[model samples]
Target: MKKVILFAVVLFGALIKAQDKTDSQFKYLEYDIEKIQNLYRNNKVTVKEVVEAYFKRINDIDKNGIQLNSVITTNPDAIKIADSLDHLDSKFKNKPLFGIPVLLKDNIDTHDKMPNTAGSLALKNSFPLQDSYLVKKLRDAGAVIIGKTNLSEWANFRGEKSTSGWSGLGGLTKNPYILNRNTCGSSAGSGAAISSNLGIIAIGTETNGSIVCPSSFNGIVGLKPTVGLISRQGIIPISSSQDTPGPMARTVKDIAISLGTMAGEDKNDKKTIGNTPFLHKDYTQFLTLTGLKGKRFGYVKGITKGANKKVDDLFLQTLKILEAQGATIVEIEKDWISPEISKNSFELMVSEFKDDLNDYLKSLGKNAAIKNIDELIAFNKNNKEELQYFGQEYLEISAKSNGKKDKNYKKAVTIAQKGSQQGIDSVIKKYNLDAIIAPTTAEAWKTDLKNGDNYENFYSSSSPAAIAGYPSITLPMGYINELPIGISFFAGKWEEGKLINMAYTFEQINPQRKVPQFLKE
Candidate 1:
């Protein structure tokens, strides 16, 4: 009788202990950098405690409950790093992003135990020897590198018919809003993880729609900074002309905070030379609620053609909100993106992909699983896991392409850059506009691995900004049937501050962001 009683007592105590460890309060704690800093300032939470809470949330919600599969691998040294930060002098506490946890898309090199696979099984064991330029910047700012997030395999550049968020090694990263819905990639995991509050902030690299599209679908703020604003030194390549790493976060202010820390010139990446004059150490000064007042915005009407009627209705409603906020709306015709530019853009990417990817692989030394596109194609064919959902047709096409030295490639680059830049420049000059506004993307489509992505009635304004190598910011605008949609603000080169101001203003007024319910559709 005594033994039975003792056993019952021990079981009850164990259950209570487990409940304390996975406390529900910590699970949904809003760990935004500002909130976290406030807590730290008040001595309410230590950096180690914050890191532990995030880990607990990841274990409970990400690993077990909804099984987001967003995180590829967590840093084993995260707690240790946080502990060291906790011991920092009070003077160092004022540093931006001090002790905040950050996740990076798997494509960005980290020179740590985690391999920079870009969601490919081929490079699953390949560890980088040096951190990427941005990673070094984040670390210097006292950000606790928590983990790497899954991304679309090869940033969705490997295959013709590919599903966003599906990776050979990391598997499929599901939308947090609705479990069955897709999180658009190749920054899908970064979008979903940040939306689900798995981490405070995440970094996602974009060649085109990779950052903004996923951010829209997953309902977060994603900033695709100007091509030169952030270095692309160690990121896996799709197109050297378009690829850029940017911040994904729950709020525009957080995006602004991250940008201040990350935006700087790198000696290794020549493109960053343009950023020298424009870089600002603190972007939060531009976060004004009155930013939209008296600002002139050009509305791009052409891209709304294939959008859902309800989404278009929301867009119209948003226009009214902007007008109410004292902004002048100028309707611009959709004559900017010419067919020739669109056609040449793909050719440019193919040429750049072959050239850039080979160079990236060469940086990995002789032991890289697949050193070049030809070897990558061969390896994908041999690996059943890689081809289970889609074939690497894009890889084969890129492999057969003439390198960047081709005259056709050079022509494509000039045409693409000139056309896209003129597209935005013409509209801005014509209207004397501050920035252009358009729907970031359609709602999150259903995840379909068998037929690849079911992109139904989807149109995006990302192309113009992407091709121009300019800056664009996407923030939550509204929702349709529980799926979130975002509105994008894009402008010319080195105009990220203006875009950020406009986005932050809109965000403050609208405040349409909602936490995902993890519906199991």
Candidate 2:
């Protein structure tokens, strides 16, 4: 009896110690990609253990504690894949993203059991026939697809007055900072999950503010790369002219590391072919603490005026930091994106969306839930949950459009391309500027279940970059009323390297981002 009691006590103590160790990993959640890799090198944590810990965090924080609802589905094979990575051959040991677990927005297809629902119930069981080009690249770079994230249904182009983070399938993704606040749209889960430390990195697709807005609201670093930098081969379509997947993480360093692996020409995306010259095999080489020195950045006017005055105050403080770091800040007029350009860009996207969407759905073969935009609209009408909050106005409009072959599409694309690209080009040339800096978007607004997105009263600097297909980076500047505000650096096509360098320097200097409080609001 004494021996048995002793054995039981010993086992209980060991379990308590183990629980304590796991509980102490709150700090571990803030670790960047490089730190996690370092932990792997030192054998302090195995890849399997790392993934398991994230699973715990997701269950406790995302699904249970406050129910962030950021993750739509977790990869069932993540642990098995991580274990295999732990036993990888010597040649595969040094891969850039070896053993790193990443989350993909649900819109991006994965051949694995996980479905690419794009946060819609209609295709909740739809798995891709193959991995997306970006996923293929990430997998090759030693990254593991740990799961798919919740996103704005149809990437927020589905309907009129649609809420940013609400989806028919995954529910609404709340801001990590304040549980009642929004996570912005489209890439909503990527931003929330990264900020909440659910995953080390995530991929978010953007046709406009989707990537940066979520990142800004969640207080993380997000990059919307040049349209061709990352292939859109298996992603659910939005605007073919504007859509591209980009990396989201807590630090700019991880962004650079991830970008290197994802950038390459692919036969599936012909736009990538012409941009191959701009692709860097290793982008981390461009990162430097002194990168801000001797660089000229144009600061756009009226961005801070878009919303809270506190953000404007923060922007001014950032300008002082930039000058102190040896950067020349020049005030640039906000004429780079005109109303005419915005109108034309929207027209082109409407047509391209119908055409591009049909192509992706057809690519899924006969098992696809619904075949085209027309079917999608009809599905929403029949399913009450799909229209519980908003109507599919955009899908209806796209169904009525003539598609890419339409004369209006050609005219819109031509004008949108020439006007937007040239507008940004002419300004940069005149000012001899390396990039244009502005507020990424307003601080996140309160999530509205009935009225939909409340960003109309807020400022957003995403259109110029999105329409022109330029690269842009948004990083935490500071916070306003506990919500984070982000500063953006965007410029000509293929300037991702320059943007990374500058954003990294600012990040290191300011370092304002902090883990969310999950405030009850």
Residues 1-521, candidate 1: write the lDDT tens digits.
Answer: 00000000001111111123333566445458898899899998899988888898888867786688999999998999999999989999988999899999999999878889989889989898899999999998889999999988999987766888999999999888878778889998899999988899999999888899889989999999999899999989888888999999999999999999998989989999867798788999889887799999888664567446666788989999999999999998878678687678888998999999999999998888778988888888889989999888788888988879767998999899889999889889989999889888767777779987764455667888888899999999998877898999988889888888899989998899988777755
- Which regions of candidate 1 fall more than 4 Å away from where they truly are? 1-24
lDDT of 1 at 412: 95
RMSD of 2: 9.8
Candidate achieving the largest lDDT:
1
Alpha-carbon runs more than 4 Å astray in model 2: 1-27
Per-model TM-score versus the true fold: 0.94, 0.94
Instruction: Summarize candidate 2's per-residue lDDT along 119-191 as a digit string, tens digits.
Output: 9999988988998888989999999899989998988888777888889999989887877778887899999
- The TM-score obtained by model 2 is 0.94
Give the RMSD in angstroms, all C-alphas superposed, for model 1. 9.4
